[model samples]
Target: MRLIKPVEITPAKLISSNVPETDYPAWLVSATYALGDRVLLDHTIYEALAAVAAGVKPGEEVVTPEAPAKWQNRGMDNRWRMFDDKVESLTTNPGTIEVRIRPGAVINSMALFNLQGKSVTITMIDPVEGEVYRKTLTLVDAGVTNWYDWFFEPIGKRTDVVVLDMPPYGSADIVLIIDAGAELAAIGHTVIGAVKRIGTALYGTSVGINDYSRKSTDEFGNTIVVQRSFSNRAEFDVTLDTSEVTRVRRLLAELRATPVVWIGEESYEATILFGFYKDFQIVFSGPTVSDCSITVEGVI
Candidate 1:
C-alpha cells in the first residue's frame, strides 16, 4: 500500500515587547469625539484630533468625510507571528517522524487527521513522560476528502517530549479514491458480472400485539388469552443471465449472513431485511440464463 504525505498543525506563540493596550472602546460611526480620546477599530489604534461629530478610527490613515484622518498607529513591526508547524512527508516514513514540544506549553486540544479514508489502528507514545494515549479513529479520508476526522478536543493534557514518533499499531492499507459515476469504459478493472435481480426484503414483520389484553370479567379468577404478533418476511428469486454456476453459488453463500437494504418500493418496511438463510437453491435454465432463487429475510 502507498502511504501519502502527512500534515500536522502546531500552536504558535505571539511575542511582543512594550505593547500598549488596544482595548479602548470602538469609535462610533456618528459620535462626537474629543481630542486625545483614543479608540480602537479594525485591529488599529486611532485618536481624535479636534472636537468633531465623527470620524476618528484607530489606525486609519484616511481622511474620509465622516471622520478626518486623526488616528495614530501604535503597533510594532512584528507584533503577531504565526508559526509554520505543518509536518508533512515525515509521516510517509512511519516511525522516523519526530516532533519537538516546547517546555511549559499549554495544549488544550489536539487533533490528528488521517486522510486515507480507511479505518486504522494507531498507538501514540510520548517518549518524554512515558505516557501513552491510545484510540482508534474511524474511516478517515485524505486532506482533500475527509480532512477533520480525528480530534481530541479539550484534552487538557501536557507533554514534555523532545521528539515523538507515530508508527502503525500493525499493518495499514492506503485508501484509494474511486468514482461512483464512472462508466465501465473509464474503469479498466471494472468487471460487469451480471444483471441479476438485486432487491431487499425482511425475514419477519413488526408486531403490535404482544400480551395485549383487556379485562372482560370482574372475577379475580378470570382466565385471559395472550395475543401473539408475527413479522412479515420478504422472499424473492434472482434470475441471472449468466451460465457461471460456481459464481452464482458463491454469491448465494455471501448473502446468507450479509445485511441487505432495499428501498423505494412500497412494501412492509421495504428496506429492513437483516439477512438470508444459508440454504439456497440454484436451477439451470437453458444454456445461458440460470435461476438462482434465494430468500432475503427480515432481521426483526
Candidate 2:
C-alpha cells in the first residue's frame, strides 16, 4: 500500500478556477452585515444571527454592541468545498469544471473522491515546456456478473479515481478538468500529495461505509427512516520489508487522526481511502517481511 500525506492548499497555490461563488459574498470587516446575511470566511459560510457591526469578524466573538454572538457558521462554501477535507459536502458546478493549480512543491499523486463527472482530465504544463504530462480517466465501473446482468442492468459509475506516478514539478501549471456531459459536475474531495511507497497491497482488504442514518420501526410495524449523512470506512493490511519498521511507525504516528490518502491498489478505486486511521498494528513475524493493518474512519 502507498501512503500520501496531502499538502495544505492555499489561495496562492490554487491559482485559478472556472467556477465562481454566485450565492455567498466574501465577508468584509468594514461592512455592517444585517441579520440573516451570509458571507464566506476562510472557505466556510457563516450567517449573521444578529446585527453584525463593522470590524466584527464572522468567526470571532462579538464584543460590546454586537454582544449576543453575531455569526452562525452554516457550512463550507460551495466554491471551496473540495478543499474542505470533508466528504459529504461537494463542490458543484454545471457542465465541465476545471481548476488550475501551482502546487509550489513537488507532488506525484492526485485523487478525486465522490465526484459526479463521467470523465476526468489532468494535465501539467511547465514554464519552458508546453506540456509536461497529461492523462484522462473515466468513472464508469463494470459490475455485471453475467450475460443476463449485462443485458438487463444499466452501467454503474464510481465516485472516486486515483492518478499516480504523476511527474513532480514545483513550477508546473497543474490543471484538473472534469466533464459531466452537460450534467452537474460535483466533487467532494480532491487532493494532491507526494507518494510514499510503504508496502505491497495484499488480500483480505475490506471496503464499505458507516451508515449514520437513523432508522426505526413504528408501533404498527411500519418502518421509518430518517436519512442522514454516512461515511466510508476501510480495513486493509499491507506487507512490507521489516527493515523499514522504524520509519513506518514514525510515519503512522505523525499521520494519526490526520486526513491522508491510502491506496491499497492504484487501479482499484474501492481501495482508495482518503481519511484518518484510528488504530494500526504492525507485526514482524518472518525474517525479512512484516505485516501491518490499518482501520480508517471517513470524515463526514
Candidate 3:
C-alpha cells in the first residue's frame, strides 16, 4: 500500500493566524502606538489606552494604562481614556502629557507601545462589553522602534478578521476504502486495499486554447485564454479473495454514481475511473486469489 505524508512543514510565504478566527498580525512591543490605534489580539480589538511614549514598553506593572490613575473606561458616557503623562518623559512620578484629550474630546482610537525587551502576551479588555482580546508579540528588541496603526471602528464593530489560505501542496497519503453500509463487525469488511500512487502537486486549475497556431494572430479570436478545471490522477492496488473480488468490482462500479472520494480523513469532490482492472482475473489457488489495480481521475 502507498500513502503520502508530510516530511516537514516548510516555511512558505503563507502565514496563518494563531489567533482564533482572525488574521490580524500578532502585536509587537518595540512598536509605537498613539491615541485611537487599534489592534486585534486574542479575538478582540484593543484601542490604545493613551498615546504611548516614544520609548515605553507595554505589559509593565510599573507603567500600565490602568483605570482612574493611568486609564479610564466610563460606561455612563461610552468613553474609555488613559491619562499617563509621566510615561512620555520617562518620569517615575505621576505627570501629565499636555496633548491628552479632555472629557469632551471625541474619542477616536487607541495605541499601544512595547517597552518590554522580549515578546509578551497581553489581553485588552473591552470597556463597554468587558470582552477580552489576547495576543502575543515577537521580541521587540531592547528599545522602542517598532510601530503599528489602527483606526477605530464604529461603537459596536468587531476587529478586522481574515480567513486562512489553502496549503500549497498535497500529501501522498494512502487512500482507505470503508464499507459505508456495514454494521459493526468482529473482524471487518471482506476486502481491504489502499491507493498506491497519486499526483504529487497540489490541487489546481488549468487553461486551454481552441487553436494552437494562433500565436500572435491579430484577430480577437486568436488571443483569448480559456480557463479549465484541474484534474488529478490516482492509482490503487489490492489483493482480494475470489468472493471479495466481486464485491470490490461492485464498489468500483458504484463509485461512478458518486460525486466524492475519500482519501484518508480528507474528502475531495471528484470523479473516479476504473479502466485499469475492470476485467481483473482471479487465480484458483488454495484460497482463490485475485489481484486488482484501479485507476482514478479526479477533478479538484
Clashes (N, CA, C under 3 Å) per candidate: 14, 1, 20
Ranking by TM-score: 2, 1, 3
Clashing pairs in 2: 1-199
List, residue by residue over 1-300, the lDDT tens digit for candidate 1: 000111222233112212233447766878877878766664344666666466534454566798556655543111111012111111221112112332122222122221222222333334453434444433322223233433523222110011113332222211112211222101111010112223222243222211334436546877675544323244445455555667657655655554333221222223222233435567777687666544444332
> TM-scores for all candidates?
0.25, 0.92, 0.22
Model 1 poorest ten-residue lDDT run:
185-194
Please report the TM-score between candidate 1 and the true structure: 0.25
Summarize candidate 2's per-residue lDDT along 79-159 as a digit string, tens digits.
788888887788988998899888888888898889897899999999988798999988777698899888998889889
* lDDT by residue for model 3 (1-300), tens: 212211221123112211133323334656677676555433333456677554443333264345322222221100111112111111111111111111121111122211212222333233343423344433322233334222332222111111111112122111111111232101100111123222221333221212323234355666645554333445444455666655555555654533222231122212221112223223333366655554444322
Q: Which should have the higher TM-score, number 2 or number 3?
A: 2
